[model samples]
Target: MARRRWWELPPAVRGAVEERTGPVRCAEPVATGAVSELVAVLHTATGAHFCKGIRSSNPLAWMHRNEARLNPYLPGVAPRLRWVVERGGWLLLGFERVAGRHPDLAPGSADLARVAGVLSGLASAPAPAVDVRPAAVRWAGWVDPEVVDGDTLAHTDVTARNFLVHAAGVAVVDWSAPCRGAAWIDTALMVVRLVRAGHSPERAEAWTGSVSAWASAPAGALDAFAVARAGLLRERHRGSGAPHLGELADAAEAWMWHRLPL
Candidate 1:
């Protein structure tokens, strides 16, 4: 399928969308993953809302729906699910846009702790009977026992770009990669991403440890899973054509091998 340009959206469709969503002043595409397109829409009355467009045939539609269903349950952890429109084999989900700096650009121990607490709450929540897969399972042999057994809800994509620090608190966005697994899996991904971005190894470790401590599991096991899962994620993203991803993955792999003991 040819990549659909944001400007190419039909006036009728755009108008209908705006009417349903409120008054959209500006719409700009925000690139994140390969399967879906995210548009950050600035509404004159509603402020900002993110419109996530997904193909009807995409296997991850279940994940998106699950996220929508789970958002209300997680009051402050995620953006509010505003509206969902299905048209022409596409699912456009509108979410309240989180306003603030990306966690990576403005790293702080307080922010990390707040995010950790939010994740922990989500993980401790009762698991849904959704068919979402475990992220650790995707990497096969690199799987960590803690992640495999915890079976908590995991936001597989916990990168800084996915986290939005707002006045209400930090809200995590982009739920297309939600997983039904351990909270440690999410923590590991976040720590690894931060470490890859030049955060001190000691700081990353400490943050991970603190998050794990809040989780209902042994810290050592969670740490092990975080290390191994970080390695696997880095290895997979290392081949990505995106220069930043490749660079981050390479750095994460090095940190996994050097800073983390086998």
Candidate 2:
């Protein structure tokens, strides 16, 4: 589970990126994420650009590529993709740097409203014509047996780490997990994170209702998502040693508790 640092990247990979952005004045390795092999910012004459990649042999390399392909369709939600390079057995992707901080999802944080507003816009974004897994297929074992479906492109990973609060607006970064599903799926995903960050089930559900798709979603589908997410999180908590996993599993359970009938 060790991560590759900025200096550890192949000279060819760095050179390939430099071809687009000029010399890397400084390369800062970002230590926040878990999945990707590399995540960092390259300081250049123009400005800082975020970059990340994984080894070609790794099966998840396709995920890095998928983000590059999904960038244009992401519209204003994500930072613009600058360039992508496949070199030295790695897939490198560069994105325009946005000056911002992660939004606070804690109780009473003003950002709750802004983040909901952003999710509402997603109702208007249909899945682009690309070969991507549908949410039902993607979340198969964990979601309802009914295969909850939709045409809107959903940013399945709605964790706080991905929402960048900028002077421009909240830019939802990290499109690594794009799924075609009910537009409301996004609102539900965000509500999970909201509950993780300490929102009560009532408050979290209230925030989700602000989004049209969520407001109109069939009660059965939402109930199914609740149970399925709790089941998935419980399964994850059992396998992982991370302390936070238990807390997250508990949060998902809280949401499930709100949905299930006596």
Candidate 3:
């Protein structure tokens, strides 16, 4: 979807936001992320905060609500939600701005360890009693529903863009797809991303050594997830014809093959 600038927001929507955030001195539009109609850093006299929103008519608009609802439960690993704005057919969420860059997931980057630490921390996050679907149900046809079942909260989208590396630590963003799943699900998802970042499948799996959830996850369950993830990515690539999706699909395929018995 095409991104809308902060100024493009309806006057009513902007007014509703300023009512909470005060007048915006400047707005820096965010260029990353595939979703969201309007995403920008609104700078006010007090401070700058991140705001992302979509028109209520969009089918995925519920994602904004979920992110707002889930942010409270994810303190250290995710940004804090400051306020919400709903006006003129748009629902916007304002978040405490996180100053960070996308993590470098390559073989030797120091950021790798930081990424591992954040994911490991997230592994123990108690599942919030929200309306999120179970991971098994979300991946039902692609993965063995039983293997992905667990009680911890999982940020299903573990892409590099969803993670921000900063002075404090790695903060995971984009909670639109949170789910109830196995504790190691995020780490398992990251393995495919590790391969996409230039690590061979063997080295990528090895990188998980520091993540306790990955170490304790049932091998059979991990294997099931790998295969299903590869298949799912392939289908997505075929449907969207997006180059990055194809690259990730290839990475997932390599990981799936590596997890297969010798």
Candidate 4:
């Protein structure tokens, strides 16, 4: 998607946002995220709000709505969704601007400890009764569909980019594709991301020591999931040809091989 500045939006769309926020004072574009036609922090009479918007007719538009619907279920773990506005063929979302920086996931970074604590909190949360896709369905082709079932809501995409390390703790963002699955699944997913960030597979798995769900997870299920995740990453990389996806796919395969018996 082409980058869109706040002023570039149609007046009707800007007016819709102003209705909730009063006059907009300034807008600072956020450059980190891959999605969103427009990602900016809007300063207004209401203070600062992180706003993301996309054309309403886009195929990925449902992701915006999914994030809005799931935000209520995630109180402290994520930024609160303040408002949603649809006008001039665009859908805009406003979120409370959390003051923080992206976490460092390297082995000795202090931020890693905070990330572990936050991931543990998420693992313990029961799945919200919402219309979300199940992990079993998402991994059906690559693993035994039944192996991924559980009552916990898993933030399957636990990359370093998705977490904000603040004074209070860590906040996970981007709830667009969360799924219902085993409580240990997120810690498992993070393991690959950690490996991608320079942790050896052994140390990455060791970091999950504080996440109780990881300790109790069935060894067979963990093995199955690693293989399935690696397979999926490989397929996605082949299709997208994104360098980062290829790197991540290699990391996932390395983690999967590390789990196998010699």
1-262 in candidate 2: lDDT tens per residue? Answer: 4689878888888888899999999988887676788889999999999988889889878788888888987868789998998999988889998778889999899998889888899766888888768888988877763546888888888888888888878898889888888878888877788898988999989877678788788888988888888888788888985777778778888998898846
Candidate 1 C-alpha lDDT tens digits along 1-262: 2455545655655665777767666676665545564355545575777777766677767666766666665535777888777665666778877667676423564676777766666666654665656655654577553445655667777777777777877777777656666555666666667776667656766665556434456656655665665665566675556776676666566556555567
Residue 72 in model 2: lDDT: 84
What value does the lDDT take at residue 44 in candidate 2? 93
| Residues 1-262, model 3: lDDT tens digits | 9888888888988999999999999999998877799889999999999988899899999888878877877647788999998889999999999999998899999999999999888997778876778998899888777899998999989988999988877888999988998999999889989999999999999999999888889999988888999999999999999999999999999998998956
Candidate 3 local distance difference test against the native: 0.90
**Per-candidate clashes, comma-separated:** 1, 0, 0, 0
Model 3 ranges with Cα > 4 A deviation: none
TM-score of 1: 0.76
Runs off by more than 4 Å, candidate 2: 145-147
Query: Ten consecutive residues with minimal summed lDDT in candidate 4?
Result: 69-78
- For residues 207-226, what per-residue lDDT tens digits would candidate 4 score against the true structure? 99999899999999999999
Q: Which ten residues in a row have the lowest lDDT in candidate 3?
A: 68-77
Candidate 3 TM-score versus the reference: 0.97
By summed lDDT, the worst window of 10 consecutive residues in model 1 runs over 208-217
User: Candidate 2 overall Cα lDDT vs. reference?
Assistant: 0.84
How well does each candidate superpose onto the true structure, as a TM-score? 0.76, 0.94, 0.97, 0.97
Assess each prediction's global lDDT (C-alpha) against the native: 0.64, 0.84, 0.90, 0.90
